[model samples]
Target: MNPFYFVFGRSANMVLILIFFFCPVSPSYGYDPLDPKGNITIKWDLLQSNSDTNDVKVSLLNFQLYRHIEQPGWKLGWEWLGKEVIWSIQGAEATEQGNCSRFKGGQLPHCCENKPLIVDLLPGAPYNIQTSNCCKGGVLSSMIQDPTKYAAVFQMNIRAGGAADSDFDMPQNFSLGVPGYTCAKPVQVAPSKYSSDGGRRWTQALGTWNVTCIYSQYQASTSPKCCVSLSAFYNDSIVHCPKCSCSCQGLPGSKCVKFGETPSLLQQVKDPNQEPPSIVRCTQHMCPIRVHWHVKQSYKEYWRVKITVNNLNILKNYSGWNLVALHPNLKSLTQVFSFNYHPLNQYGHINDSGMFWGVEYYNDMLLQEGEVGNVQSEMLLHKDEGIFSFREGWVFPRRILFNGDECVMPPPDDYPRLPKNTARAASFTLSIIFSPLFMLLIIFAC
Candidate 1:
């Protein structure tokens, strides 16, 4: 009896000590100060979702908070805090699921069942929290859960080498409904017409052709040492003939008379012994002729023409003067008078001494009875008297005058003798006889 009582006493003492050490004295509660051992309580705000329906059976669903340290430049490093204490409201509709417990290894972490988990934060420390759905084949899987509901809150340490908290804000929300619906407008065009000839057309109306009359200066014939008429010839017509006291024929006239036909010849025939049938010949006459002169007085004329062309069709590039011959009728009766443009140059200059005088009738209609040997005259001039005068039935030859060249008849015998000095002596006598006539004109004018 004594041994049993001692053993029982010892067991009772041991039991009391064990109860004092192992049993939770006040519901296993612990305290963590809200501040970092300071006088002020930590201020926090819900950064993500502030309200929830509490429909999920997972911990930390629809949770978020941000803790900010009032002090500047205060940094907090990541450190594990003990498991959180959970509480349930009375009279709430509780599901059959057990109360959410702190997750151990191999168990889906406590936040895995929630859409998002709340993170415990230190003041002024960078942190992040994440959550994922662990259960398969549920409505949560099919529907896109709100990322704000699973976001964690934390304060970022405003210090060097500190990353910003990732789970602080909510992700952009999108609807799971049929992908949301947009379109552009069409451009406008105008109509146009097509041409059959592939060319632009224009309207037509009446137009007038303007005409002008160009007058040529008076021209002298090519015959030598004879007084020729000055006249303007137009379109093969002798329009104007100046009247003067000179031995000049209009179109055609005989330079000599037949010995038997003239009255003087009849008188001479009556006195048969006196040089029987001697003829009284008329003086040589110069017929007016037409000629063209270039405006510059140069044999070569440079014509500069400026054409304002809106449209032009040219087959080939061509440049030069186009000379047209004057009609023979005009050339016959018109006289071409010229003046020297250069004194020393006898070739191109116009000089009174180098005048051209000759008759150029095309048919006997304008010629005297004996003027032309025949009805038709194709030859232009006859070689005679050093003058190379044109004769009856003589034809005009086409000649081109080049620069610095003379248009004289071919020379006779190359060293042909000048007419005898008697002719020159006779010319001097005539000049002497004519000197008084000029003196009288000067005296009359005075």
Candidate 2:
């Protein structure tokens, strides 16, 4: 009834329902109490985050402000501003190689890198992360000294001698995902303790952690809206997805074709020009799907592909038709994350080529002859990854509206879907600096 519903509106993400047992990997490390000394440095090398090498001022300060802090989730735009972030606190130091990324202010997932996160004892403190759940003690301390420059200062409450009478404790809120977004599983905590100096010095404990996933509610702007019930976008009336070739549940006839049903005969465009070496303008030489496409619209940290109905044959009231994109020469294809309609399976592969298909319906009204009907979808693409989101979809100029009479591919000065192409993965090197105290130290705060 609303414009958004007509176009693509926010749809519930397919979570909870599709959940299977997410087996937690056993942790190799645990908590051990250390002398509440001058300054203790814990290298929290976080994963799936980016640092600003571009913004020299902020990037430089980040080193000073968050010393020894690994896997910092703060973004260039001061992203972690008001978001609630949680860390699994046990006394165990992360394996030199196996550190997981913290949640990226509701943008990313928490997981081990292409490299698995390995946590073990902290040098002399080889305490196994003992707690069955993580960080159950209570809120220790936070460093929200300046909201303007830091969001990573949110929470870190693991202290010694808490109500649990256990040496280790996680913040009161042991899990991530608050309100609109929530964790799909129950959160647990553990503690590790090692006593030296005859129990005077001890490796108080925090618990071992169970890896889990978070579910985020739909935000401000969702895109390229489509019927995303089962990885198949539906126009319903057109009922032409899965192509009736791979598999289908619909009936047979003009409605359902025998296997290998060819589309209504139309002169197929010449073989699509070889995949362009780099992202470029769509040309007449390019396929009609490419020419009729527009910017992969940017929507809050993500992007979506938008296409205009160039075919007048799609007369108004047309329903149940799937939009297809084929890239004959696509070489590398993998998804960094799992989404509903944009999975690798949805993009069928045969030999070296592949085709991505989605169903779209035009306003439920006739796409009056020649009157271009623009259809947007709910397929959200990560921003930095948007330009390369599709191995072969046409790249367009962002911002400008689609003018039916445009002659050039990206019009003129329009840039690729992603406005800026900075690395989302920031790099950090450990340069242990000595403090005036003359005692060894850990750094994570200014």
Candidate 3:
């Protein structure tokens, strides 16, 4: 025997297997294998200018399939290549107006900062300041969910007095100021086209450039936000989410409070001003969100499943939240209750994926930690007798995603297993034992 195997024995192999399944793995940044072509592109279109200033229409297009900008939405910033100042802006505004003491005449520039941070206007912005697709408070949905809401646009006029021969250089050091994203330098592309009067007339930009950005979960520098638990009807075993599935207690941004441990902590959680994704009820898994999957019932032709989502973080409410499950049985789904269901057939002809969310004005907004901190739904799927089996964790979902982030699932060994003396096993043995007698009786009757 090899010395390594002789010394470690079979127990050592089990330890290695657990490590392979539970331990965190380092992931590469800037590319996602699942969504390889997904990216957010910033398009800057310089419109035809007859005056001294340059008019530009900047649009942020979300080309990603599932990722979206959530509340307290995106902040876009860039450094000017030249001494360019914003003369006027519509649909968006600069966060700060820097010192403009050098210029002493005429209408003052809207902003004099060399590197101004821009943010989208709210829905109720004045009519004079509004433009098409201008104000959504920087919230851009995923292209796959809603293509019409996947882009944000604004128009600005730049006064570059120091430019030579009316030439404008591309800006440098572009940033979304949101974590997990890094942008590439702007590349000149063919001019973008525009349609006016309901597509009757066409217009084109004088010049166009694009900046592409990609997201990396590791670069976000945050722990996972969600986890999963599982249960079944035939077994008493309930598999809770793994301990410390997201982060360990007492770590930064993992603060929690036990019942009556800190009375003030509850008050702090109730405070509207507190920061989010922390200040949760204490639990073994320090995740903000928990998704529970329960095999509710089994019938001759159909199986029922119940899904519940819990919000542990008291400081935040999830708006437009959604849950996705990958299971072989989802293709035969017959009915769903309470929540809205949609098939996400990202891969053609493979229908093993489905997405679920809450109904409008009812449970759409998952409330903070309280009596109403969760949303649940029931699903009925037609059982496929050809391959359907409850053994070896076949009934549970293969993967679960909450708000586009995959949740951590329990190990396969931890799933509920059928008892040796269960009703099904006993029936199988009885049938085998009586088969000969039953066959003889059938021959006599024939």
Name the top TM-score candidate: 3
Query: How much lDDT does candidate 2 score?
Result: 0.25
Tens digit of per-residue lDDT, candidate 3, span 164-244: 337766788899877788999999999998887899989999999999998877677567778999999988889999999
TM-scores for all predictions: 0.13, 0.19, 0.85
lDDT of 2 by residue, 1-446 (tens): 79777455333223333343354432212111110111111112121222211100001012111111112111111112122222333432222322324433553322222321222222233234432212211111111112132212211221111122322221122222112112122234343344657887775422332223222212211211121101111111211111222112342311222323333422344222111111111221221222243333445655554443332222122222223232222233333111112211222443222222223232422232233543333334354443444222233222111111112223222222222323432221112233433343334332
**Which candidate has the highest lDDT of all?**
3
Candidate 1 lDDT over 291-387, as tens digits, reads 2221111112111111010101011110110111111221222223221111111223321111111122222021212323112111121123333
User: In model 1, which runs have C-alpha deviations exceeding 4 angstroms?
Assistant: 1-226, 230-241, 247-261, 266-369, 373-446
Which regions of candidate 2 deviate over 4 angstroms?
A: 1-157, 160-164, 167-181, 186-206, 215-446
Task: Output the lDDT of residue 242, model 2.
Answer: 18
Which ten contiguous residues of candidate 1 have the minimum total lDDT? 307-316
Clashes of each: 24, 58, 0
Give me candidate 1's TM-score against the actual structure: 0.13
What is the number of residue pairs that collide in model 1? 24
In order, the Cα lDDT scores of the candidates are: 0.22, 0.25, 0.84
Q: Is candidate 2 or candidate 3 better by lDDT?
A: 3
What's the C-alpha lDDT at position 270 in model 2? Answer: 27
Using lDDT as the measure, name the better of candidate 1 and candidate 3. Answer: 3
